[model samples]
Target: MADLSINFAGIKAPNPFWLASAPPTDKAYNVIRAFEAGWGGVVWKTLGEDPAPVNVSSRYSAHYGKNREVMGFNNIELITDRSLEINLREITQVKKDWPDRAMIVSMMYPCEEESWAKVLPLVEATGADAIELNFGCPHGMPERGMGAAVGQVPEYVEMVTRWCKKYCSLPVIVKLTPNITDVRLPARAALNGGADAVSLINTINSITSLDLDNMVARPIVGGRSTHGGYCGSAVKPIALNMVAEIARDPATHGLPISGIGGISNWRDAAEFIALGSGSVQVCTAAMLHGFRIVEQMKDGLSRWMDEKGYASIEDFRGKAVANTTDWKYLDMNYQVIAQIDQDKCIQCGRCYIACEDTSHQSISQLIADNGARKYEVIKEECVGCNLCEITCPVEHCITMVPQASDKPYMNWTQDPRNPRAVAA
Candidate 1:
């Protein structure tokens, strides 16, 4: 197997897969089991200061599919409920006992610099590999001036990050909130504050649905409730886009990224790495499947790397970034005309109905060699929009063929947002 190890901003992990800061990393027991199961590291669950806050029961609920597969995980749980002294002791013992694994302390305190400042020295005393500022928790702590609320404002992001950088000698990783409009602002804020790397995304705020029987939304809070952070495979695409935005942005370019959200297997891990993530993080998947799942991820990634002739994680990182671009940079001059495979068509006019009502009226229905409804494309009328192709549910029924220099792409070129082809 090829090497799966990664050196993330001077913190090395045996592999790019690390358990995110969640239930999976809540304590030394769980973390050690995860390490034994092959996870390269663990970001300990977010810990708060002394006088630990009490948490409500039923603080988490999951969204699932027909087969009861969890598509998303929602939680109103706040930072660690364990007292600060006990958490610190455990962190110290865990690090001293297991020196090879990356043990990062996830921390959140009041927004004030003093609140964060007081916690830094205690955390560093644990000999932790790094510190992840827990700025992404979306549910219970916003009003306290922590979590997503602070994360959304770039100023707070910079302010708090600076606080950590000043007081902590270990590398500081700013865990970003996905609740913002544009991801770069917080990323830039972290970088501006001298963060060594950034890990994303914290969680997306979401309201799953209501529990009508209780006359409230779930998971019930004091007999009522509000939205919580949504996570798992459902959020993967959004997470990938945010990660890519940060990875490719010149303002934050070359920043070490810890890709989080919806990573279930090696394929998901590889995709994040290819998009320029130095390491990948997972929580929901491990919560559902347990730490043993990491064995599959490590084995699969190693085998695939050997097959692809990639000797290390760095070998293929950002390999796909060049192919991603803004809409205007797309090859609009290149076009595709719809084509139908006669043998593959099951005489379904679903394509014709779709084209006539919703798309370019290009395909004309006619009875061909056999007494079957055959659809032929009128090339001149074909706009290469791929609507017919998309409408056809049957595989290989409709195909789009490239048109060379047939027409100037004019659909979006006329928009005010199109700067390149403006009135020239």
Candidate 2:
């Protein structure tokens, strides 16, 4: 009922949900279907030079739950395998037909200004709204001195971003790799080099498993396997933390963010917005489900927004940022302890075992007045570490109860461990 329109880096999208550059946006055909399914936009799959060849079939493997929840997505796929000429032609046609949809092109190549200068004009010529430099692809291309190689170096991020700014008239969105010690460094570099926006986090380097039986892992070649970049719901926490870090960094304070990695539903999208992402991007979710999933996401997000009385997308975007603070600034008095409901407990002493072995020994098992084995939280020793809550099988069975007033402080407010902490 309310308007879902948003302007990302001066480009308009019907909503804040955009399909990330992946197989879904590998070509114009897929993007057209995605837009028809209610997706706001698509970042056309990463394109490279005139001729780029990637691996054959079986380049992808996924980890999923029985209920169909996509836990993780792994890819050895390289940049666009299509020729540059054809990709440009298709991009031109797609933008012409879907003028209202945001069309941001993702591209990667050698870390050369000439290479970028040569490519930018052609991409802009295709009438794309913006350009997202693909500096974060962790597999296949890194050995060629592209992708994550360029992304890992802050100086290279700055240099490459500056090249795009110099030649590419359209807004430049620098895609960041999460393989660094702290994401803030490269984020700062992108902003410093005049990037209009930044998108993250690219897949983390991971090796899912080893086939001990066959002595050859998946996506294997020559009886050995190399690590691939990982995506999907499993990486959501890592992506969120990195997004928050970039958003709060003073160096990249006002830069627009295109949030990527592990977005399946409207709730995840909303969380990214709260952490200061202007637009949310999806890839593996759509791959697992059909394009129709966008319908649910769009409707659900709209309904939730209406319920929250947000007249528009920007109304609630980043509202939670004001509440997020450095460790030293948090309130020290707030505290909560795990409270397990007897009815919800399955009589499994997992909570007690976990608490005793890895956490505070606050759980006590004793015979109840009714002569039943019962596990109770020792009010005196319970530190509210939350290990029990996490390992619980049932949801909402184990919850944390806030501490009483006049107790010892619970938070790390005025963190004595921080070097910047004011010496008392």
Q: Write the per-residue lDDT of candidate 1 for residues 110-200, one digit (tens) a residue.
A: 8887887788998999999999988889988897778888889999989989989999999999999999899999999999999999999
The reply for model 1, stretches above 4 Å from the true place, is 338-358, 361-400, 405-424
Indicate the TM-score of model 1: 0.89
Q: Which lDDT tens digits does candidate 2 get at residues 159-268?
A: 99999999988999999999889888888999999999999999999876567888866666766777888999999999999999888877788789999989999999
How do all models score by TM-score? Answer: 0.89, 0.93
- The C-alpha stretches of model 2 lying farther than 4 A from their native spots are 64-69, 368-371, 407-424
lDDT of 2 at 374: 78
Q: All models: lDDT? A: 0.88, 0.88
Best by TM-score: 2
Per-candidate Cα RMSD to the true structure, in Å, reads 3.2, 2.4
